[model samples]
Target: MISKTTIDNVFDTARVEEVIGDFVQLKKSGSNFKGLSPFTDERTPSFMVSPVKQIWKDFSSGKGGNVVAFLMEHEHFTYPEAIKYLAKKYGIEIEETQQTDEQKKQANERESLYLVSEFAKEYFKHVLFKTEEGKAIGLSYFKERGFTEQTIKKFDLGFSPDSWDAFTNHAIKKRYKLDYLEKTGLTIVKDDTSTGTATKMFDRFKGRVMFPIRSMSGRTLGFGGRILTNDKKAAKYLNSPESDIYHKSKVLYGIYHAKQSIAKEDNCYLVEGYTDVIQFHQTGIENVVSSSGTALTPEQIRLVNRLTQNITVLFDGDAAGLRASLRGVDLILEQGMNVKICTFPEGEDPDSFSRKNSLEELKSYLEEKSQDFISFKASLLASEAKDDPIKKADTIRDMVVSISKIPDVIKQEVYIKECARIMDISEAVLFNTLAQLLQKEQRDASRKKRSEKKTMEVVASEKKPVEKVDAQYELERKIIELLLLYGPKEEDFEELILETDEKGEIDFKPETQTKTVFRKIYLDLQEDEIEFTNDAFKELYTAITDRFMREEDLKVDDFVKVLEPEKAHAVTDILMEEEKYSLHNWERKEIYVKEKKHSVSQIVSETILNLRRELINQKIKELSETIKQQGPDDEQVNLQDVVDYITLKKLLSEKLRRVV
Candidate 1:
């Protein structure tokens, strides 16, 4: 367990924007920062972070909380892991209590997988440097490839021994579980039933140089290994199988190291392999990542999209490889990002070219050689078409198809005009082609929707009915919001009291009481025995009230830091819900929005009265239902109860100045 003092230090030192900015690209928007939501695939910016409140809200996915919650949600870190990550980032020493055996076993499976992967990364690095076989094979290989000792260690490069059970035995001997090793694809366990021998365990990356594939946060998720020897029966390069931590399609090589550079440069260099990324970094180009030779995926592109809107894909000079990679450029355009293509000299790839050039030479060549997707595609296709009318027409149509993938209308129009100039085609013809492609896409989408609707109609009768709004739930949520926002502020509240007029009749009068807002709310709810129906709200209410009982002053930002993840998320959602309105700077447009603090007393009194009225209406409803199933004697009693409840509700409505 992390000590409380250390946790406080972490929260105090870590800035919400700085910590989250490490992962998402944020631009200043009024008082807060806005960026594309990392949780959802949206082109528009819906994620906002408030520095004053020290919280963030992703309006797209509805996930909101403080710094630790962002790490927990985005990186899927355990609570302790998130704390430790922050402590490491801010350079705070953590104090810990020793864990019992049971406590250690209680860690979740995902965390266990992460621990095992980290262990493998360390073990491989130790072998690469400390063992003779590793030094001779792996160290020599990297050094010969022009990778300095600094670069090799920077990437945590390593080697697996040729022996079948070297890594597997080492991990198990150190108390790591075989189950996790196999699941992470670091070790392969096979049954040997035919030979009547014990099950065979082997290292998956045996005799291969190891490259650790990490997440954006720098956690080792898996490995990619290259074979050292020519073995006709084995794959030349192998990657870890899909696991709980690694999905290759979503993971980019060198992303952990390149994110900051990508954001700083406002451009990302996309390549085809791990060596290409490392070599570019070695040549002083830090803003580069690799697809690991897999086709580019939208998820992968979105990862870079969070850092920059510009991508320069570095391709080899081979015609076949260039054609294959051109399709990925359309995917980037579809994401509303700018794409540029740069190819190397004949017979040279990014790895060899980068290794051979000095930092200055490499940088200059990239700047001068890069071309926008429009010019590159047009010229390449024009050469291939070569005076054939049919092929020329096809080439023109192909450029239009790529232009249509862009989401911006102005960019599409600009690209269309440029394509016409380059391909010697009429602008009108290209516009018509773009229109036809877009219409066909929309029609196909509509047709798919219609087919899905027909399929859904068959089971429409079995679908659950939509639920009506829960008035009590909303009222309870408002109560929590008030407590969180103005809990410790002193205010004069109008408490409704029962009194008698000159005649012997009952009347309601307002009695003024000065107290803290939290105290007022606490007394009212306790007086009525009201409890929140929503579990999250209920927990938050209890937490806030308990804090008020123990302390005179409460800072919402500091208070939310100590809450459990779900309750903290609930608090942020309630607190920042109104902050969104202020994000648009409506007040600057002469459309001033009213501040809630100005009428806190009225809002608090109305909320309590409304809650009371809602509870009475619920009781009246229950009595009415009881009246339906009762005998004559019971029916008269239930009817009288309903009548009394209605009278109370009417009085409450009158107090609120609302018509029933």
Candidate 2:
């Protein structure tokens, strides 16, 4: 229920680049900022943000919008949440009217779960600060572990007491539903057996220090809890079970806090635990996130890929620990990202090392010790292999397997050469091994997929991502492009018609005229009774006609903002895509792009007339089929229909000929 005035204030104050730049690594590209698409796994940046227009277009995902739209898309936020987030970030005060009872009841189930998770985070933090047990155990433990008060507050660290039903009872008293509490894995629900009348519910993270896991935009999705005791039967660390809003495979710990830093530095340091990430950031390495000791997933790798392509994984120094993380790091390599390894001294982790060393000393150690993936993996394995030929062969094969995971052919080839030089093996041999590995992997995949599907597709998954562009769609896009780019500009348009001379010969008669691009196109299409067939383009066409008729001038930003999200996205794609041609300035090189002033009539007539001709041609084809279906002895009405269709076709053909 945010007021429209508040939303406008947020829009006016928030800069699109500053907002998106927190989540994306944007490099200056002419007047816009360009970065890899956060929505797709792309190496070449197709995501473009225009400061002047206050809009962004991701050609890869076909998503484009203003600052609010980007937040809603990137953060999975509702409309009001997006507005409030921007308002808070830009220091704009929000004015919200109270919702009616019916309006409050309209909140969806997914949003309820989100509300529950957020409530749990606040409750846990309150316990840590206010309660006696929390202060003695949770706060004391964090302080003893070298976390300062600022760090604790920055991360929203919290505590869950040992008492069962403490959080559950509190949540219920606050009008939260138990269904959502259990769904988010914050409370455990148990059924009574013999009595069957009573149900048991207990706190899930009791007697633990809590770390709230957040999405990239800082919404609490789940929690990671670490136990303070060394109970032999219990697991030390427990995380919130998977829920509707939280998929562990898709979430990265500390991503919310580290996203801006990662983009600012243009590099990210991959660690293994929450404490490791916090300690690193505290010691001046802000671009860091942890996998929370879980194996890295492709989804998690792609989350980091939006900010930077380069990753320096800070692994434990032990040989076994380094070897243990190889498979996980391979997932990073598979995403077409650059990978480096920086291990701490023996028996030290990122947490210990960062806390012990000065900021400059820690940075120097990282810079001086970091090595590329191939070299790091080679030397570490070689030391373990010693002079054993079998061990060395195993090491070589392992390195080859990792190299094959790289999607970039050129990067794979470069790494293969380096591996060969380091392992002292033949490049051909390693290349053959890589080919064998890929072939076997492909076969395994085919068998698994074939088992599930009765029929196998001939096309590969990679080939299908690129959709085929239809001719009609391209033409429709071109029309919109022309109207959006040059609609307001006035230009000379020659008028020409085919005429007959005294000898019955065809001749040309041309007349000079001038009009705005909008007026000429509108009149041309209106005269023919033509309408765009595509829904998106048709909607745009209607809006354009209405605006040009009512307003003294046409403006793109106001027009784009009024369209629906999908239509707005399409408009932006067309506008931003066409900018490549519109913004291309050859005058800088002393070579001017030739103007088409004399051909303006042809350009305008062709765009409208060709579309009309296509529509007529389709009608003619339908009439021919209808005539074939009916015999020559058909009804008089059908016969008349055929004759009229033929006449219409001939007239349309003559029009096409005249234009030529």
Best by lDDT: 1
RMSD of each: 2.5, 5.0
What does candidate 1's lDDT look like per residue over 1-660, in tens digits? 999999999999999999999899999887889999999999988899988789999988999999999999999998888999999999999999997878867888888899999999999899999999999999999998999999999999999999999999999998888889999999998879899754789999999999999999989999999998878999988999999999999999999999999999999999998999999998999999999988999999999999999999999977775776799999999999999999999888999999889999999999999999999999999999999999998888888989999999999999999998888778998899999999999999999999999989878868898789999999999999998789888898878887777875567877888998898989989998988888888878888888888886678789889888888898889988987775566778999888899989889989999999999988998998888888999899889788777878888888888421
Model 1 collision count: 0
How does each model score on lDDT? 0.91, 0.84
Q: Distance from true position, residue 55, model 2, in Å?
A: 3.4
Cα TM-score per model: 0.94, 0.85
Please give the range of 10 consecutive residues that has the lowest summed lDDT in model 2.
578-587
After TM-score superposition, the amount by which residue 274's alpha carbon in candidate 2 deviates from its true location, in angstroms, is 0.6
lDDT of 2 by residue, 513-630 (tens): 7988888888777777767779889888888778878884667766666566777777788778744432334567677655555555567766665676567667767767787787
lDDT of 1: 0.91
Once fitted onto the true fold, the runs of candidate 2 whose alpha carbons sit more than 4 angstroms away are 28-33, 50-52, 195-198, 408-417, 424-479, 496-510, 528-539, 577-601, 614-660
